[model samples]
Target: MPAFPNSCFQISVLLLGLAAGPGLLGCARVVSATTSAAAADCLVYVGTNVASEQENTIYLYRLQAATGTLTRLDAQPGGAAPTYLTMDAARRHLYAVSETQTFRGAASGGVSAFAVDKKTGHLTLLNQQPSGGGAPCYISLDRSEKNVLVANYVGGNVSLLPVQADGRLAPAASVHQHEGRGPHPNQTSPHAHCILPDPSNQFAFAVDLGTDNVYGYRLNAKEHQLAPAAAPAFTAAPGAGPRHLTFHPDGRYAYLINELNSTITALQYQDRQYEKGPAAFTELQTVSMLPAGFTGPNSCADVHVSPDGRFVYGSNRGHNSLAVFAINPGDGRLTLVQHVSTQGQTPRNFALDPSGQLLLVANQNSNNIFTYRVDQGTGKLTPTGHSVEVPSPMFLQVVSDFTR
Candidate 1:
C-alpha cells in the first residue's frame, strides 16, 4: 500500500447493524485539533462527558488525513454520557449510546443515530430510542448494520434496535436480561458491559462485567430478535471479571479481556457447533495486563486485535498502559509482546487507524488523543509526535469519505 496523501478524506455512515470488518483500509495522519478546520479533508468525532453540558457532547473534528492535523468541526450535545460510539460500514452514519439518563420521557437509557454530512463534516440527528437498560456504556452495529445493539453497565441488560430506510432508529426489537453472580463482593450481580456480534452474525455475545461471564445470544435477523444461545453465558475465572472480547478475522479464535483480574484469556471458539453441552467453549491461555510486582486497583478498560490478526492490545486504567501481545495464528494463542504507557491517565479507549499503521489513544481523564505509528513488521507502536487535545475524550473510530 502507498503512503496516504497530504489531505485525508474519510466519510462514515451512521446506521444500525452495520459491520466494519476486522480488516481495514490504509489510513493517513489525522487532523490535529490545534490547526484550522479548513485544513482538514476528513472529519473525526469524539464522545465525551463534562459537567455543565447537555448530556454528553459529540465534537466534530476535521483531520488532514495525510498531515495528521485536526481541526475542530461543529459539535452538538448528543445525550447523557455518550461514553462509547460506533460508525456504520458505509461511513455515512454514526451510533452512540446515552451512558445514563432518562429518554423518551422516562428513566430509560437511550441510543440514537446521526446522518453524516460528509461535505461540511456536520451531523444531522436522526432518531433516538430507549436502550431498554440504564447507563449504556457500549454499543455495536452488526455486520448487516440493520440492528443497533447496546449494553448497559448499570442497568444489567442488552437492547437491540432496528435501522430504518431513512437512517432512523426504531425501538428495540429484542432485549436480553442477564442474571448471575461472581466471586467478588460487587460481583454479586450482573453488570452487562458489552455485546459483540460474532463474525458470522448468526449469533451475538455479551459480557457481564460483574458476573465474569460472556453471554451468547442467537441472532434472529428475519424477525429482528435475539434469543439466548443454547448455552447462554460462559463463565470465566472466579474473579477475572470478563469485560470484552474480539474475534479473529478468520473466525476461529476469540480473545477476551477481564476487568477485575486485569488479565486476558485467549480461547479457541469451537470449530464446529454442538448439540451437546455448550458449543464447546474452552480456555486456551491467560495473561495479566500489569507487569509482575505491580499492585493497584485493577480496571482494564478496552481491547482489540490488530487488523492482520497477528496481534492483540488491551488498555489498563490504574496502570495507565497498553498491553500488547503477539497472536499465534496457528493455535489461536497469544504471547505478551510489550506494554506501552499511553502518555496520559485513564486511556478510556484506543483505535487503530484503517491501515493498521497507526494507533490513536484516547485518555478520557486527561482529555487527549495520542497518535502512534504502528510498525507493520514488528507490530510495535512508536510515538508519532502527533496528538489532539479534546475535553474528556472517551472513544475513537475511523471514518473514510466523511466529507460526503
Candidate 2:
C-alpha cells in the first residue's frame, strides 16, 4: 500500500471547493466531486452490553473521514445484548449476536439480521434465528455469504446458520459440541470464542479459549455444516487460552492471540498440502503483548493485521493498551514495535477503517470509542483526540459506500 500522504487535508479542501462550485464547474464535475466525498465517509456500528432491564440496542454513528470525528446517528433495538457484529460481503446486510443464554424462552442465544440503509445508515430488522448455543461471542460470514458461523462460549460449541435468499437467517443447520478442558480454572469446559474462515474458503477455524485449541473444519456449504478437518485442531500451550486467529494476507502465515497468557503465537501455514492432506501449521514464535515489568493481571481481547500486512496489533484489556508489532515480510515473524495506551479501561474490540488510515478502539468498561491515526510508514498509532461516548461498546464495524 502507498504511504499515507500528508496532503489529505489539502485534497479534502480542493474536493469541497469543486463540490460547492456549481457555476464555475460543469454539472458532471460537481456530481463527481460530491460522490467522491461521500465515498470517503463511513458508517460505524457498535454492539453494546445487554442488561435485563435495559433494551438491547445497536448504536449507529457517522464517521467523517477528513477529521475522524463521529456523529451519533441512531440506536436500533436488537436482541438481548448484541456483543458481536458482522456484515455481509456486499455490505447490504448486518448481523449481530445476542450473547445471552436464553432468548424469548428458548435455551439458546439469538442471531439477528438487518437490512442496511446505505443513505441513512439505519438498520431494518430482517429476521432472527437461534444460535443453537448460549453466550455466543463471535460471528463470521463464509466467503460465499451462504452461511453464518457462530462460537458459543458458555455452550461449548460452534454452529452454522444458513443465510436465506433475502439476507435473513435460517434455522441453524449444524452445531458441533466441543469436549475437553485445559489447565486453568476457566478452562474446565470447551469455550469456543471465535470462528473464522480460511482465506481459501475451504476451511474454517474455531478458537476455543477453554480447550486451548484452534479446531479446523471443512465448510460443507451445500449442507451448511462444519466437518472436522483431517487435522482437526492445533494445540496451544496448556493454559494459553487461544481466543482469536488472524491469517497473513499472503496466506503463508497465521497468528493466534492467547487471551489467558497475554501472548501471540506465529505459525507457518501450508496451503498446498491441504489438497491431498490436512492443513498444516507449525509454531514459529510466541511473544508477549504486555510491556516488560507489567505484573498486573491482563487478558487479550482482539487482534488484527494491517491492510498492507506489514504490522500486527493486539489489544490488552487490563493493561489498557495496543501492542504493535512489525512483521518480517520474508519470514512472517513479528518483532514488537511498541505498546500504546488505549486511553480507556478495557479495549474489548477495535477496527481498522477500510481506508487503513484510521483505527477505532471500543473501550468497553470506559464506555468510549477512541480514534487513532495510523502512520502508514511506521505502523505507529497516534491518538486523534476524537472519541465518542457509548455504553459498553464491545465491538465496532465500519462500512463505506459511494452511492450514498
Alpha carbon lDDT of each predicted model: 0.73, 0.79
Which one wins on lDDT? 2
- What stretches of model 2 exceed 4 Å from their correct place? 1-39, 52-54, 274-279, 401-403
Clashing residue pairs in candidate 2 (N, C-alpha, C atoms within 3 angstroms): none
- Give the TM-score comparing model 2 with the true structure, all chains together: 0.89
Task: Report the backbone clash tally of model 1.
Answer: 32
Once fitted onto the true fold, the runs of candidate 1 whose alpha carbons sit more than 4 angstroms away are: 1-43, 63-68, 274-277
Cα lDDT tens digits for candidate 1, 76-177? 877777777888767677888877656777767888898877566577788888999878988987767788878888788888898887788988888777
C-alpha TM-scores of all predictions: 0.87, 0.89
Total clashing pairs for each candidate: 32, 0
